[model samples]
Target: MTIMVLGIFIAVLTFCLELYFKEFVIQHFHSIADQMVDKNGVEPGNIEKFYSIGYHNSLIGLIIILVGFIPIYGFPVIYGLISFTAVGVVAGYGYIMDYDVIKTMMIAFVPHAIIEIIPILYSMAVGMYINKNIIKRLYLKKNNTSKLGTMCKKGMKSYLLIVVPLFLLAALVESFITTFLIDRYL
Candidate 1:
């Protein structure tokens, strides 16, 4: 209960912060996009396509981490597994394309990646907790809230309090870390 409450607080606070700094966020994203394009020698069209793919991938991670509440116990673990696997695959692809360049890119990214991944892990932990309740309700059908209305409301609140903050933290880590790394290393 306490953890859930804290998550909710963090999520709401983060959401508000994101809104307040919307322009800054946009500028940072533009910079990152520029960097990726230049470093990869991607054309404008290809850059757009790659960005779209990345956006979809991010959405997938967000959705899975959010909907993971449906399963309860294994949801977070499964989400983590999938997320890491996806990262690994992408990293491998990057390496295959240009190993030395990719290694440099990874170094440039590691500082921010550490911060960005923390919130994701936190969200997965929350999702796992919710998943446990879902499984309990499914199998035991005991001591559980049965109404869809109640569940939806609860789920929304939980998501708002947990997942939202995580998204914001990721943005922050990306913005600040990327800027710092680029100025220092690049």
Candidate 2:
């Protein structure tokens, strides 16, 4: 639920960012693609791409789930950064294809965007929730290693149990279905 809400908000925010800083955002993505191209060189097969997506998305999930150790600032900042990158991606795709923002976004988001985005959002939500409780404990001087350990364990359990599978599914959809759809339709 939190993931859905934040994802929607971030989608809208992405549009706004597109309106204001289009060049910068598009350039950023070009640079990232350039770096990836320079590194990968040869195009990966679909299966390799799928596995790569899983690995990268899982890393994002882990960062969101684990950044709770830094309390209020860490998870939220990373979450926002991730969200900003998503926006840039949408905007950048539009620029690269010379498509209008709306058309580009329609193609980008419809296929696998929700599947890929929501899990990380949920992981970030879980991290933020745990961080809140930890902050409360600190404020009350009720904090201890055992309690924090328990919280970390509980948060990680949920993230691993829930987010990991979702990431895998998202990766599969993105590498297979989404790209196929995009190639066929767009």
Candidate 3:
């Protein structure tokens, strides 16, 4: 899949960049970690944290869907940004902690990342589906509004039934299980 290739590319690029910009990358990772904490400098309780993570991811899914309207440039750019930023943080963690990059990712990132990445890729796929329909309508002189409307409705139903719930599950896993794994094993 295109999303998988793009995510792998971004992760590799970020890991390579980390070799050169270790300090900068680690600083950004710390800043991100800081953002996860509350004003009192303590992490919020699991329930509150789960809600926060779920809300943030759902907001991103909504934005990705809305950005599908731009037809060409919007989706890929946003997708790459999200992928690279996340991978970069993992790379930074590897650097600061002096762990094998791939191993660290497997142990600390993979559990929740597997769940989180799926809905994101699904969002991108939906965006691409919309783009394909738009291109067919505009560039190819195909006025298939009925078909497009049907597809759009299907996409919306799936977004509600599938993507949103997956993101919340991913958030729950990330907030609770991933944290425990990192603390206990990593």
In terms of TM-score, which candidate is strongest? 3
Better of 1 and 3 by TM-score: 3
Q: Give the worst 10-residue stretch by lDDT in candidate 2.
A: 76-85
Model 1, C-alpha of 69: deviation from truth (Å): 4.5
Please, what is the TM-score per model? 0.51, 0.77, 0.84
Q: Residue 120, candidate 1: how far off, in angstroms?
A: 2.0
Clashes of each: 7, 0, 0
Number of colliding residue pairs in model 2: 0
Better of 2 and 3 by TM-score: 3
Error of 2 at 149 (Å): 2.4
For 1-186, candidate 3 gives per-residue lDDT tens digits of 765777778777766777788777778768888998879998788789799989988878766766766667456346535755677657766866688777777777788779988788778777767767776777787886437677678778878888899999998998888778778876
Ranking by lDDT: 3, 2, 1
For model 3, the stretches where C-alpha displacement exceeds 4 angstroms are 73-81, 145-152
